[model samples]
Target chain A: MLHLVLFLVFGAICVAGAINLLVQSHPISSALSLVVVMASLAVEYLLLGAEFVAAVQVIVYAGAVMVLFVFVIMLLNAGVEERTKGSRVALILGIPGVLAGGLLVAWVLIERTGTATVGLGALPGFPKTIGNLLFHDFLLPFEVTSVLVLIAIMGAVVLASRPEPKNPEKES
Target chain B: MLSLPIFLVASVVKIVLVIFILLTAVAYTVWLERKVVGHMQNRWGPSRVGPFGLLQPLADGVKFLLKEDLTPPHVYRPLFIAAPMIAVICALTSISVIPFGTAIPVAGHIIPLQITDLNIGLLVILGVTSIGVYGVALAGWSSNSKYSLLGGLRASAQMVSYEICLGLSLVGVLIVSGSFSLQQIVESQRGYFWGFIPKWNIFYGCQFVAFFIYLMAAYAETNRIPFDLPEAETELVAGYHTEYSAMKFAMFFMAEYANMITVACLATILFLGGGNGPLFGPPLLRLILPTFYFVAKVFVFLFTYIWVRGTLPRFRYDQLMAFGWKFLFPLAIANLVVTALVVAYRS
Candidate 1:
């Protein structure tokens, strides 16, 4: 009963925060709302017995990644986002389209899973368990993901760097 | 066995007790800082209010409570309010997992000195405290001042950078202890090697480099002197908290000291054999001695924090970043690798 209550509360927070993220004009407010969403999702993860994943979600996503987003927004001094002037038709249809997409995904998920029940404290979330699974069962995918991340980092550095002037005094 | 309600009551009592003690400790730490720093500068420090300013924290608390609480017109009001609360709450929460001593059997109930224990206690602490970085960053950003903005940016960057080394340094301890539960780690450090030396990680397991990295990163993590560019008073005009006043400012102050205490506690648990000590006499002594040792180790670390604050000059922004990335990161990684190899070979 307690678990169910916690799940419902956090789930409500997640939905509320996500909606706020969409509605808020200021980037910092949106970013903070997204953090709230992520934190609520982390609680849901914890409720599902994925403690390590929950911790990782908070530490990496909510803490580091969202902080980066906030930093960029602050550095750029981004105010309220100006509404795009592209097409009224796209804007008018986008809301209903998004709602339909969400319903379809939920329908598909429910249909596929049938009456699958999630039991609390059943799934193991120990680091050792995760380590074993990653190393033995999903080693290739893990290694590939890591390599992809490394490449992306290198690409970013390359794309962002500028060539230094041969004659420093000439530039000055 | 106790009923569910009884267990719940016990947990609440424990939580309240810990919070009360931690808050008191944080307040005293502030008082200690002023006195120690003053004495170092060749001045009479706080000798007026109740001998060595013991009542100073009370006075400050009342003053903060009664002072004009200002929310600057230009500031982001919600975030400015939330940030310090988040910082303080996160800082206090990390202490939940620290076992002050082994379980004591009293009144037909086994009461562990810790509030609660999770299998992944250490990770929980790291997660909670990592969230604290957001508090400092948000505080600075929400203040709507150039000083606060710069301080916030520097704070976030420094915290993010040093966090890498801090986590890496703990890999050595985790590898040696072969557990993520802090209680289990402390248990693994019990007893002595060769009858004299304590079986702490620093000496027995030879993790001096890891300890050093952890210590330095911790100093940076808690935003203490030398690494406290986030609040460089002369340079940034009180940094991220420039616009904050009254209880809001007090919240940030308490949060910092609480973070320092948590770091000191972790260092003791990970490397100084946490609350593990010899008991030569009675049963009460046995129960008390462990906690005594734990407090002593933490006090020593806190003293070092203050001592360093009095001695070292603050690092320049560029210099702090360079040192954290160029020096501490690689050194921590090397120490972890060496420890891993040693542990593996021995096993």
Candidate 2:
């Protein structure tokens, strides 16, 4: 009973934060709202018994990634976003389009899963279990993903670093 | 298993007790730092207050409370107000998962010294402390001053950089213990290796290198000397809290000391065989011995913190970043890989 209540509360917070992220005009406020969303999502993960994943979600997503996001926003000194005129076409089609897509996905999920309820913390989300799975079962994919990340990091370093100038300035 | 009511009551009591103790410790840590640093510099620190300046923190608290609460006109009001609270909250919250001692039976219920023991206790501390960056960052940005802005930016960058080293260093201990739970890690370090030397992670697993990395990373993380480029007094005035006054400034000060205490506690738990020491005398003494040992270890760590502060000069911005990335980062990686290889081979 307690788990369900807590889950609903955090789920509400997550959705509310997402909406706030979109609504906030200031870039910093939006970034902070996104952090709230990430944190609430972590709570949701905890409710589902994926303790390790939950911790990682907070550590990596809410903590590191969002810190970088806020850092960039602060460094850039971004101001409040200017209000832009809405496109007539988007206004006419966007709302209904989103509604229909959401309804379609909900219909499909309910049809397939049929009101089945999994008990809280039913899955083997222990760090040991996850480690075993990552190492033994999905080692290849994990290694490939890590390599992909490495390449991205290398690319960033290359892009960030200045190339040697044709003529160096003389030291005073 | 404890009944729901008993569990809830126990948890609340533990929370209250821990917070009270932690706040008191935070206050005293400030006193300790001043006294030690003053003595190091051949000066008497806060001697005018009660008995070796024992009442200094209380006097400071009252002064902060009575002083004018200043909010400059040209500042982001909401975040400016919220920033110190965020910093202090995250600082105090990380202490929740740290086990001070073994469980004690109370009215037929086993109550652990810690507030709660999450399976991912170490990660929780890491996550919460990581989140604490925002407090300093936002405080700087919202203050609408050049010094504050520079301080905030440096803090974010430095913390983000060193957090990697901090996390990496602990991975060695995690591998040795094979558990993320702090309690389990402490339990694993119980017995002596050579019957004389305690089988702490540093000695038993040959994690002295990791401990060194962790120490450096922690100093950086807590914005202590040599790594405190974010709040360099000579360059950025008072850094992130330059514009803050009264209670708000006090909150930031409390947060820094609280973080120091948390880091010291973590070091004790991870590397010093937390709360594990010789037990003697009556049954009651045995029950209290573990906590005593834990506090003593933490005191040593805290003293080292102040000692280093007194001895070392602050690092330049570029040098600080270089040291973290070029030196500590690769060293931590090397330590992790070698530790992993040894563990794998032995197993």
Please, what are the lDDT tens digits per residue for candidate 2 over residues B202-313?
Answer: 8955599999999999999999997888788998899999999999999999999999999999999999999998899998899999999999999999999999999999
Which residue pairs clash in candidate 1? none
Error of 1 at A124 (Å): 2.2
DockQ scores for all predicted structures: 0.72, 0.84
TM-score of each: 0.96, 0.97
Grade the docking of candidate 2: high
Off by over 4 Å in 2: A111-114, A167-172
Output the TM-score of candidate 2. Answer: 0.97
What's the residue-level lDDT of B171 in candidate 1?
A: 86
Residue A21 shift from truth in candidate 2, angstroms: 0.8
Per-residue CA lDDT of candidate 1, range A1-172, in tens? 8998999999999999999998898899999999999999999989989888898898888878888888888888898888767698888998899999999999998999887867875577888899899999999999999999999999999999988899999988
- After the best TM-score superposition of candidate 2, give how far the Cα of residue B19 lies from its true spot, in angstroms: 1.0
Clashing pairs in 2: none
- Candidate 2 lDDT over A27-139, as tens digits, reads 99999999999999988888899888988999998888999998899899998899989899999999999999999999999999899856777766799999999999999
